[model samples]
Target: MSDGFECFKHVGLALDPIHVGTGGARLGRVDLSIVRDPVTKIPKIPGSSLAGVHRAYVAMAEKKYPGCAGQGQPDTSGAGGHCCDPKCPVCTVFGFAKGKDSTTGFTGLAAFSDVHIQLFPVATREGPLWVTSPEQLRIAGLSIPEDANADAVYRKSTSSQPLNLGWLLLPVKALSEHSCIRDELNKLGVPKHILDRFGVVPDRLFSHVVNSNLEVRTSVSINPETGAAEEGALFTYEALPRATLLFWEVTCKNPKHFKIGNKDIEAANNKDKVHSLVKKAYPYLEHLGIGGMGTRGMGRLRVLEPNASSNHSSEIEQSDKDKSQEARH
Candidate 1:
């Protein structure tokens, strides 16, 4: 097997508040809470959730749903929803387990990473501002000013007035004129309006600020028989607010060296093929949404195109041109 793999970073803009629940109510301010990183205490979407949805959407896109969308549990005849054919894009990109034996399963060619918040929107006196931190910028592969630290808020706006992030008021410090943070943000496809009001807060306060500004809504269950609210049915939940920017990475392994059921996969002979196949499902993620509570207007995320230079940059440009030409028709 070759040790060749390519990793691609993707940025997404939330169109609706996203809520990936923790399965049950927590004894906190809200009855229902979203999953959070244990160390940072910051909310994040698990890679497993992303993988499951991406697999299903890819199957649907390839017109192979119901067969290549499940766990591939065999039936009486030992066949399953997964075709287990090496040539199948769905099965090749996302591995399958069949034959009721561990030896028959194949690990998938692509792996997903957890989605992390890049720019969190917070309500402030200056209007709705996107809040980020030095640590957050570093994680997104952006450079911060040499003098920038986690002690004060930094922004390009010359306003000397203190800013209120949620209920916390913080004094603003003018960002360095040489800082390339804005340019980097632009390359990531952040809206110009959002960048105009961007504010960088101390890393120590980022978690608190984000949690304080999260969208919380109260819900109640109605009695099926009487058209009345059920007793003790009122509850509250939190979600990552709309317009939040998030980042995630996908790693595609070279598929030329892998085989399934003694047959090599011809569809994904190159790593780019595997990456492109997985990206084809991104449109589904944008339209159909991710996370939970989709029917109630939540979890819609729009994946932005990568504008940075990379090995596949030319291919991406060509693809965009083709899309534009198709739209003109």
Candidate 2:
């Protein structure tokens, strides 16, 4: 009962469109549909997907590829590919399973929450704007005035004219000068241009607006035999557009409380250590990208650091200082 669990919030900007597909074609507008939240109908990046990619990247970074990257294919001797070594950063932070496991598995120290859209970008007559909803703002720990009109759009701009969000247009109401939403977004390091064009729609319209404005493209498979587009091979898919902002949470458990196949984890002895090890793989994510259709120029996300007011900022700053001191030595 050390109360050693720590939660950290991560924000990311999509450098390219992201497509996390639903595996099979749906009987809808697009042949390949992206995964979506059933309740809200808003697309999201699943925690399982995040965990899998992070494990692969961490393994690649440590030069533990193929073995530590996935659920190890057991040999005739009944051994797995995972190192399952407590001291290995890849295995320790991500956990591992071997054989037909009952006693040979650990669920890992880091748990990821599904990534959700925070600010979705849309094209408007004025210019491109980032759209959000009251619920989305609340999830970011910001709130609009309780007495504010729910059916009207609120924006940081002084313009009182109507605004267009995708194909739908609504009359804009100026955000109260005292509203803290803008200030909070600034603290989160949102770009000035995006903040200036940000608009808040009612929660009811959020899903519609987001889905309507998704980036959809049509593509056809090429026939290897003829070196031409294959007949009846045309398909379309949708993705979360670039310049969109998203947020997710990671909960790190103290390594001292767990054991991996009779070995104690010493490299990541604490929650912060475990968290830092996972974050080290973020840069690889930025360059290598995540989700599906990466070869088609999608899924690049730039992870942003927490600001000074963030709950975990002090720990991150201290970690940076420690690294600096070590470098000087």
Candidate 3:
């Protein structure tokens, strides 16, 4: 809460993926990019991707926010290029650069971490399930029962067949209980009133197949002159599926003194302004979406904000109860 960039604020984020693409075209296997964890091979939302999208989205919403500096440069126009308003909200929050050396602009007051996957939605015979691993949960400062079953899948028959989780299939076996995952998540301050299907699966199964379940989309460009498909315009891409859960954190630092051009802005005021803007952006984000192909209905995310108040837990619990009742009927 103190200013001066001294404290790191961890803001938990839950992304309900509505088709988000962070990369396009791999050289060997995929035509377009499907960024994955190098070791686990599971799809991931990189920090760079989230940070770029966030900065762009914030800038676009405000009129005073500086536009592009150049074709491939952010500081192309030099010191004279930007509006350079000392009090400009966008300039102050996102940081601005100017002049040839560009040594003057204050580094951004906020830091964004890569949005890591907390849960992956999988289909099973019993119902919809949100699959995750104990290790994955632990990485986010959470702990799950070590002895809990990891390989849990639903099967229509006991014919020694594998379970099909969308594009990936595995041998049917005893699966972990959703209650175990739900309890741990609740303790970690997850809002139960939110998405109700989050569950836990074996880490091995999750890592092996979630990437294969990604949504692959094919696209082609049209030739304006003849109104025909362009000869070389066809391309294929992939995006995260709907209901994919992701997390990210933003740390706001209170600066001692920051410069917005020649004028000095107090550190406390700078921190306050950025935090305020973030709160305002929450509602707009659901409507606008983020990442690539937003116009095509990709990258719609909802953030669950945790309140420390006594009523917070009870409120979410009530919401969860209502959702369960509705589903029952």
Top-TM-score structure, candidate number: 1
Poorly placed runs, candidate 2 (over 4 Å):
77-80, 99-102, 144-149, 177-179, 309-329
Per-candidate TM-scores read 0.88, 0.88, 0.72
Across 1-329, the per-residue lDDT of candidate 2 in tens digits comes to 24779888788999999999998999999999999999999889999999899999888888888787887656778666777777788877887775344357777899999898999998999888888887787776676555345666677666778877878988887767323665566567675456556777878899999999999999999989999999999999999999999988888998888877676887698898888889877998899999889999999999887556632334444665898899999
Candidate 3's C-alpha runs over 4 A off are 1-24, 68-80, 83-86, 98-103, 148-150, 153-164, 167-196, 224-228, 257-263, 266-273, 307-329
Question: On a 0 to 1 TM-score scale, where does candidate 1 land against the true structure?
Answer: 0.88
Candidate 2 to native Cα RMSD, angstroms: 7.6
Which lDDT value does model 2 have at 260? Answer: 72
| Runs of candidate 1 exceeding 4 Å displacement | 1-3, 76-79, 100-102, 177-179, 308-329
Candidate 3 TM-score, true structure as reference: 0.72
Pick by TM-score: 1 or 2, better one: 1
User: Worst lDDT window (10 residues) for model 1?
Assistant: 308-317
Tell me how candidate 3 scores on lDDT.
Answer: 0.58
Output the better candidate (1/3) by lDDT.
Answer: 1
RMSD of 1: 6.5
lDDT of 3 by residue, 228-304 (tens): 99999887777777766666667665544665556665423756566665454565566677667676667767665
Give the per-residue lDDT of model 1 (tens digit) for 13-114: 999999999999889999999999999898899999889999999999998887888877778887666777778889889888754543678888999998
